[model samples]
Target: MARLSGLFLCGALLSFACQDLGIAVEVKVPAEPLSTPVGKNAELPCSYSTSVGDSFALEWSFVPPGKPLSASHPILYFTNGRVYPTGSQAKRASLLQNPPTRGVATLKLIDAHPSDTGTYLCQVNNPPDFYTNGLGLINLTVLVPPSSPLCSKSGQTSVGGSAALKCSSSQGAPRPVYNWVRLGSSPTPSPGSMVQDEVSGQLILTNLSLTYSGTYRCVATNQMGSASCELTLSVTDPSKGRVAGALIGVLLGVLLLSVAAFCLIRFQKDRRKRPKETYGGSDIREDAIAPGISEHTSMRPDSSKGLLEKPSSASSVTTTKSKLPMVV
Candidate 1:
């Protein structure tokens, strides 16, 4: 009975030892995130430890940022001892390890874009060696340099007023940070006078004074690079501007009034120079009398000659009448 018990204990111990030695495959990747500039190549390191078999397979996949791991798409695959790049990344991606069955399944991606910023999954599979999880995850960031910022200003910047200046860059992957600087010698001109919003890239000036007027620059910076733009601020006296505007308005009003008066005066002078046409009864009577007086003067000369010749006829008639009365 003692010999039988000793054999049973040995068998039990040997079985437990064999079970412990049957651990499964495990995968490892970099713990820290990887970063690279846009249009550059990025390497995703991956490794695994297991009893590799003749039918080993490795797969590389990607999931965009803010997406679930299950949504990842295959980037490359290794089967039959050959690497096959798949999906949109096929032309730009390749295996770093030639065989990939040696537990190294690193991937090299060329010409990465800003849209490639996401998590990458490396999976290894070998039948009968899958006791453990055979997966690894790596986070990648693709950096884009900032383009030149567009600077703008709003609100009244005159003395004793407020003004807001804004700056922005549209072409940056991770949103660019902004910094505003006034190009002058006065450092910290007034505490709390200038306020800045880092995220929105807005600078506000309160109780604006002439000292705040100068060349201002806005700089946008990101992990990749920086860009900047400049603008000049000119402070004017509000009273002077209003006075000048009032003067211009007054001059324009005077000019319009002068033009109207000149037109009216020219119309009056033209009316005075034109001759008036008369069509009254007195004008017609005067025209008729002028011809009648001319006719009477011409007939008076003939009447006087007739009167002088009528005296001879009157004497002959009186002598004949006296001879008739004596014969009776």
Candidate 2:
């Protein structure tokens, strides 16, 4: 009788201690992450020990990726035989089983979006029997494919110089990686002459040569799908350019010399055939003494010969003086 009384006293003290400090409760949850495509339903599995009572309660909360639990906001909760949905997802959030009193507190989400991608916390408290972490964590992800990437190039593509190829996408749920490939048959690049960055989507080439001239393609890829773009590089030789320019200059110089020589020869022929000025015929001078009339006198008739031989003035005077004296 004395031992029985002592045992009852010890049991009462033990129950009082349990009431002050809560006991451990077991919550069952999956070890793997959850996933679903956009615009589809998703299930985050959670459950606990069958500790149904008048004050039984359960809560589901969420936070974005990389955020702490302290930042989580309530999505839905159940207590006092009533279910209340809350937060931004309240309209589409619900429980898998009516009144999760049967131990199934799995979260049900309808038409999930990329914004819903994050971590979820499920907690349960059965009064007088819960204390040590009656909670579980779940990670959810939304799958998405890559978008068309923009292709571009930088630096001159001349021989003995360097060039870089770039590619990028404007929108994609999961960030994508890049890859490059030559369109036609291409020789293997020397070890140190080429460099590529898959994350940044860039390919750099040094010591460019004529063999590097070709069309190249870039592909952006993720878990869902891939998109691609294309670009071309044409390497030119500097020596060939110099040779062509010199040949053109020489041809122009020859053409100019030929034109100058033709002009000089034409001027000489025109000078040799030129005529001289004349001052004869109608332009004769009218001056000086009269010409002799001897030729005209000889051509006259014979009767006129006596007139041409008539006397000198001195002989006529001498004969006239004697005749005048005799008459007086």
Candidate 3:
């Protein structure tokens, strides 16, 4: 029992000394890059040399390609015999070995996405053993096929004008290269008449003619796969278009004149059919105002003349019996 006690005291002293002196940590990772298709799993291998320590900790972080290390985003952490996940990758990232005390600190990623293609850092810390080589870097690439391209046209499609046809793919890994081809036999283009940019997928046609009118197909290809799109370009003569527009205008003018003539003719016919509007006074100025007054007014006044002779009896009687028409 006394010897065991002495041995325990020596061991305690040695452990304290080792902690103060510190041991260099060695971490290993693959030098070559690792690749996985999108939506697949990836294993980022990481290993370290160190005794299991109570103060041991493991961290996995990611930095997008072309970015500085300061942009590291934490994926997960392993400490105190528990796993604590962090960031968007928390649900997909995990340690290959639980309780990584056995030295393997490999990182496993499930359902890898295209956005996960970047640089990953695996770091191990065992207290005083963090003096050197405690971290490693890994490059991950997620393969993706080219998506369907969008085909479009720009500028004028009329003859003797400039025009452009464009094609592009919105999604692809390793960037897709574009190629343009006319579907059918095309006339040989004159020097400097046509220009095509494969990188930007733009086909420029200057001094366009009827020959340029055809179906064009663009193919985008990459390491994964290829996708294609098509567009139809129609060239026309501006003079013909102007003539058609003039003809349409003349037709519209004729239609408007016909409508106006029809309206005028209808107005005259309706006026002829309508009875004239008149008032009661119109009849008063006629030969006789009322039926009963006609006989009495027809009787001439007495032929005998006097210095101040009044109207004859027949005229007076006719005026008295006549009924005036009521005005509305």
Candidate 4:
């Protein structure tokens, strides 16, 4: 039993000596996630506690959202007291800690895009300091401002009916949230006769009335910025609408009838002014010859004998034989 006790004591001393000779390397980063608006710079904080040696290396790598760590690629590297940036992030990324030999390994990224949102790994390698973990993780989020929203109506919205007004914005990071307001009204629109959908950005107005006619505004907001759009709603009395339509139709019919009558009258006048055509005939004149004496005077015997006698010239006389007239 004494020999076993002596062996356990020696083993404990050896374990303690090994512990004293071991070098610890630990990496630390912020516990909270980091965020920045698009087109801005982001600084990833990283620090380490290690028994570093002359042969030390620091590496910064990125793993895109939803990707495995094995798929991560190097963003920058530090070795031999020199910094080397790599991949697409070479021009935009740099070491915040110059000579990064004093346990500082922060990285600065400029002009961050939405695609830059992901996980970053900071790893430190000191040859003789390998007992403790030497890696840190950082999560970054990139924000994009909302674009102008589109507003539209989906129903007739007449009196005693229903309608739906919708608003949407397609461009924004973190998905934009939407709100609606009735123009010229309070900031929080009264929800007395309408149903609002916060998720879909739709408003349903039930049993609509003329009082609902006005301008409506839609606002979309995200972490970065906001945008708005406005639309007008007009309501007309159904009875007045029908009366106006009837009057318009009657006036149009009257106009059509007047045009048809004018066209007929013009056609008849043109026909009357045109020359008439004659077929297969020559023209005869009534004044070509003079009329003879009256029949009663011609029947008298004395008138007949005078007509038979020829007139004598001043130098010569001519005689003609006469025939007696028979009474029948």
Best by lDDT: 3
Off by over 4 Å in 3: 1-22, 188-192, 240-328
Give the TM-score ranking, best first: 2, 1, 3, 4
Q: How many Å off is the CA of 178 in candidate 4? A: 2.3
Off by over 4 Å in 2: 1-23, 170-175, 186-188, 247-328
Candidate models: Cα lDDT each = 0.84, 0.83, 0.87, 0.83
Give model 2 RMSD, 1 decimal: 12.3
Q: If scored against the real structure, what TM-score would every candidate get? A: 0.66, 0.67, 0.63, 0.62
RMSD of each: 11.1, 12.3, 14.6, 10.6
lDDT of 4 by residue, 4-107 (tens): 99999999997676557656678999999999989999999999886667778999999999999999999999888788899999999998879898878999
On TM-score, the leading prediction is 2
What lDDT is reached at residue 254 by model 3? 100
Question: What is model 3's C-alpha RMSD?
Answer: 14.6
What pairs collide in candidate 2? none
Candidate 2 has an lDDT of: 0.83
